[model samples]
Target chain A: MSTRLLRLLAPALLGTLMVTAWYGVHLWLDTEMRFLLPTPVQILGAFRDNGESLGRAALNTAEGALLGFGGAALVGFLFAVVLSLSSLVRASLYPYLMILQMTPIIIIAPILVLWVGAGLKSVAIITFLICFFPLVVNTTQGLISTDRNLVELFAMWRTGRWQQLVHLRIPSALPYFFTGLRIAATLAPIGALVGDYTAGNSDGNGGGLGFQAIIYSSQAKYPALFATAAVTCALGFIFTGAVVALSWLALHRWHDSYERADR
Target chain B: MAVPPIVELREVTKRFGDGPLVLDRLSLAAQPGEFISLIGPSGCGKSTLLRLIAGLSPVTAGTLRVDGVTPDAAAAELAFVFQEPTLLPWLTVGRNIELAPRLRGISAMDRAATRQRVLDLVRLGNRADAYPRQLSGGQKMRVSLARALALEPKILLLDEPFGALDEMTREHLNEELLAIHAEAKWTGFFVTHSVAEAVFLSTRIVVMAANPGRIHSVIAVDLPRERTNATRASRAYLDLVADVSQLLRSVESTAA
Candidate 1:
């Protein structure tokens, strides 16, 4: 087969095999135990019945994820800039930042709920905390690891610290920044869902997929639970896909990773 | 009365944080429009000398002056090119060329004009919109050269700028560089390993010795000022290259 055909066919083939295995397990299970594993058909039926609510939940989670991701990107970039300014500053503060990253979000979620009260605010903060570390780490590494010769070239012109950061360091750091963004992209939705699960409002109108998961699992709606999971997975893919598109838009013309082999 | 040297070094010494000396009491001077090549074995501090003159690093001791001022103070009058092209990959050829002027807060119109002039000087006028990655190795180096020239510097310090290029491209760039130098008349301090390159480009070659690097000899080239491909094959140029190579070999052996 042609490469393009193989590329498309390979994934479809794997998916067909996976669905067949899943259906076989579903059929082999005792009817009393079937609730533990909804067949693909049952999950599809759940999607048809709860499509509108699932869509709303997906949107709510997306809003929270995007807001948190934006806040993390802005604050993380500024923090990295500050850290990149001086070795003394970086040495003193980097450990504290590491400590923040090391402290699990589960341990901090309740404190966030108490401080912010359970709602979108807590959800956003939780998401921010989850996505912030990689952005700061990657951007700082990029900022510091600027090409030595380029730095000297800038220094030769008596380039001020600010100009050097803006012109040389930041541009050079972009590929790295995108790498972090992609990582954060994969995590953002998960963060939002976790936040919503722990601290979100229980209203039917605004409850995210995480809240929906709670409702479906409590009611023992196995098929609906499976559908919620598929939706969450799709949301994660959407976030990553957006980031990949943005990266291509920013870098495809110049970056080596994005350059076409044929070209 | 004599014209003052544009760059003067007196008993200059440098070392890195108690490390062994990289350049020891090294002193040299360049008249207003001299092209000086520094050639020596690896680790002889040819590059370090260029960095000191460019104000990228401070001298550990002694005095070095450019245009009657410290290198730091004279930074606006200087530019440097590295062995690698060092062109910002994110920027187009034109934007890379305009980088210094833009940072210096030159108005947009002037930046555009200066970019055009330098791009044309490097014979990359049509490639202004191309990114550094889109260009060949030689083209990237040309952009780097253009970027340095955009500064309109009075002193250009290049540390083995063409060392990574193939011989054919290296020779091509060397000819283009001399052409630009002839017109711009900047005081050039070039560090290189190629004897023929040194002879072809420099009015004076400073051969250095390693192990506490110091200038071992300075040879003046009596070839015509305006050089071309023919000059590379000329009897005088060939003889100078041979003589400099022999001097360099002797320096390396003794230093070893």
Candidate 2:
């Protein structure tokens, strides 16, 4: 098959095989145990029956993720810029940043709830914490590794440090920044889900996918739980796909990563 | 003596952070409109010398003056073209050419005029909106040259700016550079490894030796001011190229 055709057909082929295997397992299971391991059809039926609530939950989670991702990007970039200003500042603060990253989100989530009083704010804060480190580290690396020749060229012009940062270092860091965003995109939904489970509003109107997962599992609604998982997976894919699209839009004109070798 | 030397290096010594000497007591001077080429072996510090003259680096000892002042003080009066085009990838050709002026707080109107003028000089008049990545290697180098020329500096320091290009492209750029230089009347310091290139572009060739990096010989190219492709084919140009090649070979052998 042509590569383009294969790219489109390969995932669909795997999904078909997976559903067949799942059905085989469904047949093999004891009648009493069948409810615990719902088949793909059962999950699809559950999605149809509870589409309204599922959609609301997905939208709520997306809001938290988007807000958190935005906060991480803005604050992380500023932090990296401040760190790039001097080695002393980077050395003094970097270890603390590492410690923050090392501390598990689970351990911090409840504490975040205690501080922020359990709502979208706490969920967003939790997601922001999860996404912040990579953005800062990658941006700092990019800013620091700007082309030395270009820096010298700027120096030749006697450009101020501020000018150097604005014109040269920041533009150079953009590819690296996008790389960080792509990484964070994959994590944003997961962080939002975790935050929701720990500190989200449990009201029917505003509860996210994480709350749905908890309610469905506790109520032994195995098919609904599976549907919730599928929605969360779709949400993650949407975030990653959106980042990839944004990166292509911003960088395809100039960056080497987007250049076609055959062309 | 009506116009003093545009650049003067008196016993200029440079070493990097207690390391071995990169350039040792190198003394030279260039008149206001002279084009000087520094040709030597790999470790001869020609690029370093250019950097020092451009005020990108400080000499560890001795004195180097540009436009009769310390290089730092004369910063606005000089521009450098690095070996790589070094154009900011995110910027369009016009924006790249306008970088120095923009940094120096030149008004948008003046910057646009300067950008157009330099782009025209380098024959990239229509590539203003194109990004550096969209350009060919030679075109990118032209943009780089245009960017330096945008400063309209009295002194131009080029560190083997055409070294990465193919021979054909290099020759084409050399001609364009000379034409621009003739019009601008800037004192030029061009660092190159090609003897033919050195002979073609410079009024005087300073051959350098590698160990401790000092000048070995300075040969004056007594060619016509208006050089062209015909100038390259002339017997005088060929002989000058051969002479400079022999001098370069001697320096390389001594360095080895």
Candidate 3:
């Protein structure tokens, strides 16, 4: 088979096998408590029935994720640039940044709710916090890891620091920056969902997949909960896919240079 | 009467950190339109000396000048080509050539002409839109040469620019380089390990030795001015190549 056909066949076969197994398990255990773990078909039914409500929640969650991701990209890239300027700055600031990364976002979201008050604002902050670190670390590595000969070429051109940053450092950092962005894209949604769960309303009042999932769990609506969870995963997949596409478009030519260097 | 040297080096020295000197008390002068090559064995600071002239590295001692000015000032008049073609992969052939002027903040209106001019000079005029990866090894090196020439620099400093290319490509580029230099009239400073290459390209070859690398000898190339593939087969070319080879063999023995 051709690569393109194998690519489609492998994933389709896997998904089919997984869903069949799930349905078979649901069929074998036919108890009144079977409603607790909804099967694939019931989840799909629940989504069809509550499509409007779920779509709203998913949209809200997506908005918060996108906002937080954009903020992280800008702030993280600037932070990496500033951090890379000197070893002294990196030494002084890096440990504290790493400490923040060590702290879990779920734990921090409640504190953020107290400070920023629970809403999309706090959710975005939580998402930004979770997503920022990878961008910082990866982008800094990329900026500093430019080719030595290219750096010397810049010197020969008598280029100013700003020019060096624009032409050399920025382009060199692009593939790594995109790598960081890809990480942040998937994590942003998770952060937003966790933020919604920790700080959102107890009822299905707040606008997010996490809030809806929390409400479904509380009310014993297993099908809606499973459906929302599946949709959230899909959202994450879509966000990551978009980022991957962006990276390909931007760096396909020169990005291969980094790969070649690695080999 | 002596035409003033475009580049003058006197007692120049370089050492990394507190370690022993890599280059010691080197003195040389490059007159206008001179294609001077620094030839030596591996690890003789040949590239380092090239960098010092390019002002990418500071000299440890003594004076180095381009047109009676500092290295930093000298840089404005020179373009450097590395052993690896070093074309920015992100850029097309045209954009790579345009980079020097772009870095210097030349306007697009002014640079369009110069960028086109150099691309044509290197015979990459048609390949301007092609990315670095889209080209062959020779084509990429041609782009590199075009990039340097695009700046319209007074001197072109080459650090074994064809060191990575195949022998045929190397010879082809050497011929192209001579043709371009003949028309452009810029001084050239090339560093290489091959004696044949040195003789083929240089107006004068400054043979070097390792262990605090310093100039061992300088041989003036007396081949005919207008050279072609036929020139490479001539008796004078072969004899000159032999003379440089003998000098390098002596340096290698001493280094060993």
Model 2, span A1-263: residue lDDT tens: 69999998999999999989988888899999899779988999999988988999999999999999999999999999999998999999999999999998888988888887887898889889999999999999999999988887787877789889998899899999999998999999999999999888865495998888888888888899999889989999999999999999988888999888986
C-alpha local distance difference test of each model: 0.91, 0.90, 0.87
Model 1 stretches with alpha carbons more than 4 Å out: A204-206
Candidate 1 lDDT by residue in tens digits, A169-244: 9988988898899999999999999988987875549588888888888888889988988988999999999999
Steric collisions counted per model:
0, 0, 0
TM-score of chain A of each: 0.96, 0.96, 0.92
Per-residue error (Å), model 2, residue B181: 1.4
What clash count does candidate 1 reach? 0
Judge candidate 2 at residue A157 and give its lDDT. 79
Task: Give residue A4's error in model 2 in angstroms.
Answer: 2.6
Q: Could you tell which candidate, 2 or 3, scores higher by TM-score? A: 2
Docking class of 3: medium
TM-score of candidate 1 versus the correct structure, residues matched by position: 0.96
Better of 1 and 3 by lDDT: 1
lDDT of 3 by residue, B1-256 (tens): 3788899999999998999889989999989999999999887888999888888878989999987897787777888888888888898888888888877789997788987888887788898888888888989988888888888889899988898899998998888899999999999999887888888888999998999789898899998778888988899999999888888998999899
